[model samples]
Target chain A: MNYLHLLDYAGVAVFAATGALAASRLRLDIVGFIFFAAITGVGGGTLRDLLLGKLPVFWIKQPLFIGICVIIAVLVFFTAHLVESRYRLLLWLDAIGMAAYCVMGAMIGLEYGISPYAAIVTGISTATFGGIFRDVISGEKSVLLSDEIYISAALLGATSFVFLFSMGVPQIVAVFVGVLLAFGLRAAALLFGWTTPRYKPRQGRKIK
Target chain B: MNYLHLLDYAGVAVFAATGALAASRLRLDIVGFIFFAAITGVGGGTLRDLLLGKLPVFWIKQPLFIGICVIIAVLVFFTAHLVESRYRLLLWLDAIGMAAYCVMGAMIGLEYGISPYAAIVTGISTATFGGIFRDVISGEKSVLLSDEIYISAALLGATSFVFLFSMGVPQIVAVFVGVLLAFGLRAAALLFGWTTPRYKPRQGRKIK
Candidate 1:
C-alpha cells in the first residue's frame, strides 16, 4: 500500500520502452511508436480494472500515469538505435515490469477481498497481458506461446504473495518475497535458457 | 432502443459462431473452441465498457450473453464438418455481426453524451475488435490489416447514426439506416473483392 506508485511507475515506463523498441524493430512511424508504448504501458491494468470492477480505470482518473508512459515511450523512440539487440533489452525490461506489476496486481486484488485464486489470476493477467498485446500487434511471437517459463514465474509470485499474506506474513515482507521470486525465476530462465516441457498431442480421436 | 438486446444478442452469437469455426479450422479441443467463442463474442464490448467506465461489464451483470455464446459454440464444435466452406461462412457471419454491433455501439455512445467523433470510433471498435481477437489468436490475417473496407464499413455506419440523430431524425430510422449501409458495404466488398488502396511508402528519412 505504501509507496506502491514507485514500483508501478517504474514498471510502466519499462513496459512502454519495450513497446517503442518493438516499433523500432519494424521501422514504424513515430505515431506507431507512441501508440505501442501507450498500449503496452497501460493495457494490463486496464484489463484488470475492467474485470475487478474498478470504474474509470487508473489512467482516466489519474492522467499522470499515461503522461509518464507517453514521455518514456517517446524518449525510447529517439534513442532506440543506440541500443544493440533490442529484443534482448525488451525481454529484460519485460521481466522487470512483469515482477513489479504481478506483485502490485495481487496486492490490489487482495485489498479488494477477492478469493486468493482469482487474485492470483489477476496478478498473472496484469503482468503478462500487456506483453501479449505488444507481441500480437508487432507480429512477434508471444512470450505466452513460447517454451520459456514466462507465466509460471508470475504464477509463482502471485501464489507466494497470497500464501504468505494468508499465513500472517507482514504485507511488505510478502510483497518483497513475491517480487523476488518472480524476478528470480524469470531471470534464471533468461540466463540459463530454461524452458517448460511442451504439451504432447494425443494420438487420435477414436472415442468420438 | 426499445429492444437493444435483440441486435446485441444476435451479433454476439454470430461472432461466437465465427470463433467456433476458427477453432475448427485448427481442429482444436472443445476447450479451445469455447475459449475462442467467449473471447470473440465479448472482446469488443469488453474493451468499450472498460473505456466507457461501465463497471462489471455487461456480461458480468447479465451472464445470459455468455451462456448463449457457450451453447452456440459447443453446438458448432460438433457440427463443424457439416459446413461446406467454414471460412466463407465465418466471413459472412462476421460481416452481419459487424453491421449490427457498429450501430448498437454508436447508439450507446451517443446515449452516454460522448462527442460524435469518439462515438464513431467506439462503434468501429465494438464492431471489429472481436474479429481482430479471433484472427490474431487463430493466426489468420486480421481484417484490420487487410485492404478490404472492413473498418470503413463500421465507420460509415457509426458516422451515419451520429449524423442522423444529430439532425433530429427518428432513432429507429437512424438505426436501420446505419445497419443497412454497414452491411451493404461489407457485403459488396466480399462479393466484388473491393479493396482499400494500399499505403504508399514515403521516400527517404531526413538527415539526423
Candidate 2:
C-alpha cells in the first residue's frame, strides 16, 4: 500500500508536468495551462471512477491531488527552459506513470470486489485512456493507437495483477511483478522502436 | 416517443453535418472527417449514457446513426464549398441538435428513474458537450465556455422540460416547449452577439 501510494503520487506529478509542457508549447494562457494540467492529472481516474459508479470523483473527494497537480503545473511553468527536452522526458515518465496507474487501478477495482476480468480491463483503461484523450484533444494522433506497446503493456500488467491475486500471492509481490512487467515491456518497445502496423484502407473501403 | 425518435435522428444529422463541416476546414483526410463526424454525432449521448450507467453504448446498438454520420462525412468531404459559411449555419443547426439531445437525454434519465435534477443535468450535458469536446480537440476554444449562450440555452431548455413535465403537460408538448425555448434563445444570442462574461482573475490573486 505504501509503494502504491508513492507510485500514484509520482504518476500524478509526471502527468501534470506532461500537460503543462504540452500546453506551454501552444502558448496557452496560465489558466489554460492549469486547466490542461489538472485534466491530465485526474482525467483518467475521474473516468475510471465514473465508469465504476464511484461518486464525488477521486479528485473531488481528495482535493490534495488537485493541489499537487497545480503545484506541479506551476513548477513546470517556471522551469520550461530547464525541461527543454520535454518530449524525451514525457515518453519515459509516462511509461512509468502508466505502469504505476495500471497496478493501482487494478488493486482499487479488486478492493471493490469487482470481477477479476472487469478489474483488469478497467485498470488498463484507467492507465492508458487519459493519454489517448489528451493526445486527441491536442489534435495529435493518439499514442495509444500509434504506440502499440503502451496500452497492450498496461493490459498485460493488469491481467498479471489479477492472475497473481487469484493465485494467493501477496499484494506486494503481485504489484511488484505487474509494474515490472509493464515497465519492461514498454521500455523494450521504446528501445527497439517497435510499432503496430498502421491501418490502411482496403480497396473497397475508400469513400467515393 | 415518436417525437423523441424524430428529434434523435434530427440531432444526429445536424451534429454529423456540423462535425463534417468542421473537419473539412482542417483539410483533414476522409478518415479524419469520418472520425470527427461520428464523434460529434454520438459523443454526447454516449457520455450521458455512461454517466447514467447505461452500457453497450447507444451508437453501438444502433448502426443507423453511424451510417448517417459516415454519409455526412463523405458529403462534406466532396462538397466542401457547400459549407463555406460554416460558422453561421453551424450556430442554428447546433441549436436544433442541442435542443433535441437535451430533451432526449432528459427523457432517458426519466425512463431510468433517476432524480429530476440529475436528469436535467444529463440532458444539458448531452445537448452541448459533444460540441465542446469537438471544438477542444480541433484546437478551437470550446464554444461552450466562450462568449456564447450555448450551454446556458441547453440548461434553460432542460429546465423547461422538467417544469412542463411536472405541470402534467403532455410529453410531446413539454418537449416542443423546451426545444422552442432553446432554439429561440440560441438564435437570439447569435443574432444579437450575446455572450457570457469571461472569467477574470480575482483582484490581488495576481497570476502571470
Candidate 3:
C-alpha cells in the first residue's frame, strides 16, 4: 500500500479506538459506542470532502472505513474492563491520530491546489474537529479550546509538511518530519503540563 | 424590509426559542443556554455555508443572529416556569425557522447554479441539520430520525418553493407557501401523534 493509504488506515483505527474509549466512559450501549467511533473516525474527512464539493462523501463510497470503525468499537466494548487506565490510553492514541490526520489533511489540501495557509488550517481542523465533536456529543466542553498544545502542534506540523513539500522534499521525509514535530510537541505539553495563560478579570471593576 | 430578510429574522427567533426551551429542560446555566440556542439557530446555515466554501461562516459574519439567539435564550431562562406547558409554542416556532431556512438555502443553492436535485437536498439539509446538531449535543436521539414528517416536510416545502420560483411565482407567495407547508405538516403530525416506524431486531426464536 502507498504511504498515504497506510497513514489513512492507521489514523482511522486510532481515531476509532479513542472514540470508542470515550463512549465507553459514558457507559453507553454498543450501538452508541459504534456511533461515536464512526462519527469521530470519519467526521473530519467528511467535512473536508463537503467543503471541497466532493460528492457522495469519502466514507459513503468506502464501506471499509465504517466496517473498521465498527470492528474497533466492538472490540473495545467487550474488552473495556480489561483495559486499565483508559484515560492514558485514550490520550496517547488521540495524539497519534492527531498527527496522522494533520499530515494527511495537509497532503490532500496541497493535492487540491489549496493555498498553503488554508492548507495548514485545514490540517489542524482535521486533527481537532473530531475530538471537539466527540466532546460535544458527550456533553463535555471541547479540550481544543483548553490550554493544550493540540491544535498549535497540529498547525506547526502542517506548516512544516507543506513547506517541505513545496521545497521538493520527498513525501515520506516530509510526513516523518511533520508527524515527529506534532508528537514531540504534544508529548512535551503532557509531560510538562504546559498551559496557556489565563486572563483574570479585576474584582468588582469593569475593564473596557 | 425585504420579505426574505423578514422571514430569516422570524426563522432565527423561532429556532432560538426552541433551543432555549431545550436548554431549559436540561437546566443549563445562562451561558450554556445562549450557546445552545445560538448554535441551534444558526448551525444549519453555518454547515451549508461551510460546504459551499463560503468564508467566515454565516453567523460569524452576521453577529445579529447570535445577538438574537442570546436574547431569546435569556428570556427563556428567566421564564422557564411560564413556558413549561407551552411545548406547542416551541414546535410552531421550530417549524417557522425550518421553513425560512429551507427557502433561504434553496435560493442560495440556485444562485450557485447547483443541480436542482442537489439544491433541494441542500435546502432540506440546511433546515434540519441544526435540530439534529442540537439533539446530538444535548445527548438525545435526534428527533429527525424518529420524527417521520419533520425533515420530509422541510424537503417538500423547499422543493415546492423552488418549483414556484422557477415558475415565476412571486417571492412573497413562495415564502408563504413554504412556511405553511412546513408548519401545516408538523402541526398535523403533532395532533395525530405520527412517528416513524421503530427499527426492530429479529428475536430469532428457534422454530419448534
lDDT against the true structure, per candidate, is 0.82, 0.76, 0.76
- Tell me how each candidate scores on DockQ against the true complex: 0.12, 0.06, 0.06
Give the per-residue lDDT digits (tens) of candidate 3, residues B15-111. Answer: 8888887788788999988988988888888876765556578778889989999999999889878754655676777777887888788777777
**Chain A structural similarity (TM-score) per candidate?**
0.93, 0.90, 0.93
What's the chain B TM-score of candidate 3? 0.89
lDDT of 1 at B41: 91
Q: What TM-score quantifies how close candidate 2 is to the native fold?
A: 0.58
> Which residue pairs clash within candidate 3?
none
Output the number of the lDDT-best candidate. Answer: 1
Cα lDDT tens digits, model 1, A1-208, are 3467788888788888888777676565454565577678887887788778875567655657667776886687667666666788899999998998888888888888899999999999999998988889667888777777899999999899989998999988998899999999999999998888878888688855
- The candidate maximizing TM-score is 1
Question: Model 2 — interface RMS deviation?
Answer: 9.4
lDDT tens digits, residues B1-208, model 1?
Answer: 3456788998899999999998998798988898899899988887778777876788999999889889988999999889899988998999998999999887887787666766776687689789888988888866554445676688788889889988999988899899999999989989997765432233223323
